[model samples]
Target: MGKREHCRTSVLFFPTFVNRFGCGKAQCTGVPSFRIGHAGFLDRLVWPDLNRRLSVAKETIVNRSNRAGQIAELRKVVMWLYDKGRYHDALPGAVQLVDWSRDSHGSSYPELADSINILAMTYHALGQYDAAEPLHVEALELRRRCNGERSCAVAMSMNNLAALHFDCGKFGKSEELYLRSLEIDRNAQTLHNLGVLYHAMGRFAEAKPLFHEALEIRHEAPGENSSSFALTLNCLAALYFRMSDYAQAESLWRRALKIRGRVSGRRHPDYARTLNNLGAVYYILGELARAERFFMRALRIRRQVFGDIHGECAQTLDNLGSVSRAKGRFKKAL
Candidate 1:
């Protein structure tokens, strides 16, 4: 097998080990699994630390124009920083690039508009909705001017704008934008985002197909470990669990758990989500012993990663209570 294929094969078995040992007790923190000796998104990508790359990308943006090559390279660098979880640090560089790309007097105005759209995304991640909204609007205008409403570029801007709307609880606006984006690409990410939006709105029936579609796409994609794919898997698993599809749910959650082990490592707070999902599946499967074990492990991880009182910890604690009750440990359940 090729190097990438080999990695994927290993990823496939990673969760089985996690199910056996339970994510290492010491591994839980906000840090991703890849950073903890497991190769993850950051390691898979070429970019270095967020702060360092931000500086370099900013400098490159200043010296370069809106030329296709420069713009593409700038995007690559900026995206890499975002994927590394350096949302805040990416902002300054992204803003500078947006400024250059948006200057109507320059030949690069279209590029600036595109850059602004990208900036909108980074801002959305950092919870700077006010900052992101205007950029999305500006990008929409530019895209319309350059590519018309039906073009793929317009669709891209719409999707980002929709995400912003979703973040702000504007489900209608977000839905409209996602539908528009879907018309253009019908891509996995757009579908996944749509699934999340639907889930948030309590529309599970509408959400499941999108999650399933994204999972299939990820399964076929190049990487063995991806946060997006793992997330989608978790979503599907949770959905199945909610519907009492215990067998399917357990299978999916177990798969997702392994990916989290390999991609996010055993200790990240996100891993707790996988653990909780898996624990719930075990609970439903009437494996109280296994359920209690997973819940306690998740609880410890959450406490270490998020400290006491975080919502996730509370949920983990509750799961522990449930498992205890199921085992007839009344005092512990209490």
Candidate 2:
């Protein structure tokens, strides 16, 4: 077999092994039955320990008689892993989901579209944007085919594609999609995403009202203390900080931080993000000591969640270094 075909075969059979062996804790103890000719491909494509466990236990999950139930359980596991930030581990399962859906019903099936969406999301999370965009495009087309042009499903797909474009720095395309999505449904998430895009483009005046509208929608729908509401508040705080309104920014950030803390705890990435932003505000205000404390706390939490070399951890390090320099601790800053 060609390299691509061999790799595909490996992924396909790995799940069969899992299904037959059972996925429970005790069921994963045996040796994996399937083997890939290109070991490097497996190493590069899958998380080692997770792939082994899944390969052993995926088969015993449900009988061959209950295909739908098996797919549902697999989807749940894939989403759970994705939620836990195990993006690499989630990718294989997402691929299996798409394959199963397509094989059972056709490429144009609704379940195929859903699986494609999950696979795209997993790729996006893993920073494989090139791989993600085409899948997202396919998913959008499938959703439109199945649900009509102006349906909520189509609008959601637009928003997701917009997010991908925004992340890729295609601001024009992102804005166009966001506008289209807004026309279909006045959703809070779409509004907040547009606000974020505007903020990134330095269009603070245009961003502020969008953020406000999003916050209002969230407050009305899910209440003020919801994580989504806190996210909008954080975005507004960032805009205020950019405008040099330090006092206003600090107040907004603190409120958002409190809400995030209550909802997701201080260890959550959102809470750490707020802490970092608050530290920057304090640093700008010449409260070096207080800024250092916040930066340190943010660094600790980011290290716990994302480890030492991630963007967030690096940003906190930069801020801490600046504070040290301001305090005349040249050696420490270095």
Most TM-score-accurate candidate: 2
Q: Tens digits of per-residue lDDT for model 2 on 1-334?
A: 1111111000000000001110000000000112211100121223346554465438833445566666766766675465444556778988988877776668666677777877877776555779989988998899889878986667666876877787777989989998997787776667777887887787888989988887776677456765556777877877777787889989998998898787656776667777878888888889999988988998898777666766557667877888889999999999
| Residue-wise C-alpha lDDT for candidate 1, range 1-334, written one tens digit per residue | 1111111100101111122211111100011112211211234565446466545555664566544555455555655555444455556767765655554335334566656765776665545679878978887788688767776566656766776787676889889888876776665556767776776666789889887776676667644476556766766666665566779878987887788777666875456667776777787778888887888788787666546855557667777777777788989888
User: Where in model 2 is the C-alpha error above 4 Å?
Assistant: 1-57, 60-63, 84-89
lDDT of 2: 0.64
Q: Give the lowest summed-lDDT range of ten residues in model 1.
A: 24-33
lDDT of 2 at 258: 97
Highest-lDDT candidate: 2
Q: Which window of ten consecutive residues has the lowest lDDT sum in model 2?
A: 22-31
Positional deviation of 159 in candidate 1, in angstroms? 1.8
